[model samples]
Structure formats: C-alpha cells, structure tokens
Target: MDHDAISIDGGTAADRHARPGAAGAGGANDLLAHFSDPHSVARYAEGPPRFVPGFTDLHRMTRLLLTERAPDDARVLVLGAGGGLELKAFAEAEPHWTFDGVDPAAEMLGLAGRTLGPLAARVRLHQGYIDDAPEGPFDAATCLLTLHFLAPDERRRTAAEIRRRLKPGAPFVAAHSSFPQDDGERALWLSRYAAFAVASGADPDQARTARAAIDTRLNLLSPAHDEAILRDAGFSNVSLFYAAFTWRGWVAYA
Candidate 1:
C-alpha cells in the first residue's frame, strides 16, 4: 500500500515523516506525550465530543460537503486522522469511498485502526504530517480538529500541500480553532469554550486544563485569516460551513 503513495521530494515536503509542532500530536511536549500514551489513546474518543460542540454533526457535515463534488468511489485524503472517528463515520456513510489518512501519533493511529475495525481495509493509515500524505488528485479532503496544532506558517504550507494533492476543483473541508483574534475576544471565547466543555459533562478541572492548553499551546487564528490562508493556497469559493462556538469549519475548492 505504501507503493501507492506518490513521492513528492521537492522543497515543499519538509522533514521526512517528522511530526510538526502541532497540539495533540504535534504541540507542547506534555501534550504530545499525552497523545502518545496508550491510556490517552484509549480514551481519545471521549475528549472531542466533550470539548468540540456538535462533534457528530461535524463529521456528518464534512461528509455532505465533500460528497457535494466528490465521486461515489472517491479517494479522500484525511489529515490528522489519528482517532478514526470521522473515517468511521465517512466509511459508514459511503462504503465505496476509500481514504488515505495521515497523522504523526502512532498510538493514536493504532487506536484509529481499532476504531475502524473491518473498515481499516478501505483506508491506508499514513503515520506522518500533511506533506507525507499521498500526492493524489483526491476527489476530496478534510483536516478537522487538527490545524490549530500547527503554527500559522506551517499551517499555510500544509494547506498548500493539500491543495497541490487535490484534483482541480476538488472540495477540501477543514475545521479547527478559529475565533475572534482580538485579545479580549480571544480570552472571552476561550472561556466560553471551557464553559461549553464543562456544560457537556467534562470534569471542570480537566476542562480548564484543556482550555489552558488550547490557549497557550495551540496556534489559533481568526476566521478571516484562516480563510485567507486557504485562498492564498489557491483554493477557490471558500465558504464557512460550520461555526460552533470557538471552532469554525470551511469548505473550499482546490
């Protein structure tokens, strides 16, 4: 299956299979260490739904947007696909669709394999960052709940790489930590994010810790800046498709 992946050896594909400075898998040492733990990987499924508003809906909406322009037997590229929640959801929604999922967290990828079960046959789990992804003219792609892990520069490079791998006009759906960039507004929204998590039954202390990690460790940006990065990466007709409190999702065409 590795033979199916294209070898893009240009300057664009930086750091051979090395993890980026992303949050969960690629951010602070403590956080990345957390992700690498078998215990944390075992409990990964519980965190997103609690911290991210409408986690299930996010997957559904991603499938819908991707299928808007994707073929029935679409070959999709999924970045930061460590948990396999979205992969499982997408696979269940469209049996014919195949996926190439990339992430730096080996343990999380193992958990993804378990989460996928029999569905793993339809997906190739690449253990690396976006640049390590298959150089495909994929039917569609998604980078959900992952970009905030990367700094703005790395984020832009990653987006451009995803664009380059896509078929012309292919839809690329991305969702991450995008909120008001102002100092006061950022703090306010982060507080609300923590409140939402607590409201959703997250332990208050854990929620506070997660909120703090997001604020200090994740490289967040404004929705407008996020859109600009996509546009700068050569994506067209970018539009916001989901806005659940601190998170924002957008669908763009490559």
Candidate 2:
C-alpha cells in the first residue's frame, strides 16, 4: 500500500512522552530528567506493544511526507530526534540525503546514534535545539510529535527558528496533537483517544492516566490555530495532508 495515498478515517495516533512541566522550564527539566534513564530511552526506541502508544505508523507518516515533498538529495533537519527513527528511515529511503538530527537530550541522541548505526556518520547529531543545530539552508525539515510540548510562545519561537534555518520555498513537514473547538467534540475526541489507548494495549486505568496527562500537560492546538502559527512564523501555502482525530500532519513552504 502507498501509505502516502491512504486516507485517514477516524483512527488516531500520537508521539508519546511524559508531560514537560509548568511554563516551558518544567518541560525542559522533565525532558532532561526523562532522558537520564537508559531503560527509558531503550523502551521509547522500541515503539508500541511494549513501551508506549505510537510507533511504526507515526514514523511512517513522517517518511511518506518527506518522500512526497522533499527533494531526492534533500538536506533534512529532524527536530527532537529522540531515537532517530525518521533519520534512519530517510537515509535508507534516499541514501544521498544528508541529515542534521537535533535534540536536547544526550541519552536520546545516544540512542539515535545507535539507531543510525552505519548512517551515524552521515547524520550530524546536535545536542541542542534548532538554534544550536548546524547552520543549514536545508532543503526540507520535519518536526513530528515534538511541538505540542512547547507553550504557545515557545511554539512560535520554534517555528520562527525553523523558518530561519530553511531555504526559501523549502518544504517543512510536521505532525502534532490537536484539540477540538466545541465542548461536545472535545469530550468525544478525548473519550475516543482513551479507548484507542486501551485498544492499543493499555489497561483502562493506564489509559485514563495517559489521557489525563495529555489533557493537563500537552499544549495541543486546534487546526486553525496551528495554521495561524505557521503563517505567522513565515511559512506560506500551508496545507494539511493528513488527519486522524487529534493527530494532524501538514506540509508548508518555508
């Protein structure tokens, strides 16, 4: 199946991580603390049916987006490259594509280093945010399941930073969790997500806990809100290519 052409139904998926914290500081501290554990990093790299909810398909969507939008020899910027899943996949898909994998966590970068294996040398792993990443007028970039951790201001900052790093007319693909505008829709969406967790292997209590964390911690935005943020950050011709309940994916020109 050309997963790229597959239309989303009601099914949804997300990149799972523990909440960052109050303001952005709390989240940064939480991330640093979370990446401190080797076991945690290992579990995260393993994907669903073992460690957390999302895995293969989410990364697959990212891959599909890049394949469709990025040039064959694209210089790609992978933001928040926890385990290098997208980096490895992209390198394998288009061997000529060089990558810069950026993440603030050393252990996660280390896991990414291991995941990249032979391609490790091809990818330049940076232990920082987009600002600390190597200078790049990259051909394309991806920030999947990473931005929802940022506060609104931080998200704008991130968007602007990414815009600064990419060449004009470059394609940037991103996926994030979103909330509904209507109270009824919001309740229904949350309930469906909680049920998806159970179906994806979480116990009911575990699902509830996960749902609570998402509701209380993650900085999910509505689709319109996301488009506004992108446009305000300087991306033009922004268009959403995929949607599955709370999870949304878009491609915008930098």
Q: Highest lDDT among the candidates is held by which one? A: 1
Q: Give each model a TM-score.
A: 0.90, 0.81
Q: Which prediction has the highest TM-score against the true structure?
A: 1
lDDT of 1 by residue, 1-254 (tens): 12223211112223322343433334454565577778988899999999999999999999999989999999999998888899999999999999999877777777778788778889888867776688998999999988877777778888999999999999999999999979699999999999999999999999999989888877788999999999998899999999999999999999
Worst 10 residues of 2 by lDDT: 6-15
Candidate 2 residue-wise lDDT, 1-254, digit = tens: 12122111111111123323212546444545566477878777533332223555666666776667677788888887867777787787788898888776666777777777777657877766666666688888889777877777778788888988998888888887766857688768877778876776667896786677667666767888988899999999888877766677788888
Which regions of candidate 1 are displaced past 4 Å? 1-30
Full-model lDDT for every candidate: 0.84, 0.71
Task: Give the C-alpha lDDT of model 1.
Answer: 0.84
